[model samples]
Target: MNLLKKDLADGISFSGEKDGHCITCLEGKQSRNYSEELEGKCLQLVHSDVCGPMSQESRSGGRYFLTFIDDHTRKVFVYIIRSKVEVFEKFREFKSQFENQTGKQIKILRTDKGSGYVNRDFKNFLRNQGIKHELTIPYSPEKN
Candidate 1:
């Protein structure tokens, strides 16, 4: 503003508004919130969650649904399941099939700290495949 005044800005001037905040300057310093996707490469990160025990079951007798989302691409894969036990299997299948199809390995997985994902079998599978698992705090659905 001082430079503009000294160098002759024709119609724009801050000469009288010298004591308060400058909206333009403040806005210029702000930035968009950073997303959880690291480096933004496809298959780099995934988010998984299960929503189930629904009141109305699907025609196939599915009582639950599992979801797998690619953080970078925002691609979503949903699986209707008969039970929560299917979560681990569905996740494994999703990982294998997606990796094979894309020719890229998933480096990380993010999920809520639910039993379906935190069980011994699920932990073993993730460890064996070298996939990092990030768990949202329990009860904090917003973070998930």
Candidate 2:
């Protein structure tokens, strides 16, 4: 273990040999990757995604989950939904509450453009509100 090695180098001791082989540690290590910089103002950019139809439903009978992340603040809001159709209503609620509380308008929204998000009604709402929609390419969720 690196901890044991550091302790030994620092003059700590143990009576017996210590084995360092760890299956989980060897399998779990990951290298860091580049990420975009944060936004300059709260509500300037928001990212959203929906994950759903889980094999096992939650106690509340919800099969989908939605998330909204404020790019500036890195604050996350999560909600459980019964189905993907709830995404538009949830976004309306999120936008209303977030804008009212923070006294700032959401200028841009980034998402993966799933059926839940790319509907005509949803696009109309964004345009009506003067909010820009940025859809990520398929298979590139990190773009959000």
Candidate 3:
């Protein structure tokens, strides 16, 4: 430290202080919390998410996929589509089939606030069905 100060140093300070908000260390930390608990019965709280627009397509030319999971049963239903526009249609199909088989109407729909779930058509459909729609905060996938 003395040699560095005397020989080649310009304006460097050698303090023993620590940075509490060190970006390098913070960036390396992963979140370590368990997800929120799932409550209620089958068809009472349904969670849905849409994924992809991948570069590679399936044999049927599908590039997007949608998933519906029952909170109580953890039963999942999935559908593959060619585009986002088919989201409402897939929801309708899932709702009808699941409700018919389970004999219980879906009470709440939980999803991230993506355009597929927040659009006018989807909103109207949920409203007409009397199903409450719950959206997690934007950019927080862990909340979903």
Q: Name the best candidate (by lDDT).
A: 2
Q: TM-score for every candidate vs. truth?
A: 0.70, 0.71, 0.69
List the candidate 1 regions with Cα displacement exceeding 4 Å. Answer: 1-40
Output the worst ten-in-a-row residue range by lDDT, candidate 3.
31-40
Ranking by lDDT: 2, 1, 3
- Whole-model lDDT, model 2: 0.83
Estimate every model's Cα lDDT from 0 to 1.
0.80, 0.83, 0.80
lDDT (tens digit, per residue) of candidate 2 on 79-120: 999999999999999999988877779999999969999999
Q: Model 2 has how many clashing residue pairs?
A: 0
Tell me the deviation in Å of residue 98 in model 1.
0.6
| C-alpha lDDT of residue 109 in model 3 | 96
Candidate 3 structure quality by residue, lDDT tens digits, 18-126: 3533344355565533222223366788888888888899999999999999887777898999998899999999999988776679999999988888999999889
lDDT of 3 at 63: 99
- Which candidate would rank higher by TM-score, 1 or 2? 2
Q: Candidate 2: minimum summed lDDT over ten consecutive residues — where?
A: 31-40
| Root-mean-square deviation of candidate 3 | 10.7
What is the C-alpha lDDT profile of model 1 across 91-128, one tens digit per residue?
88998898887778999999899888899999988899
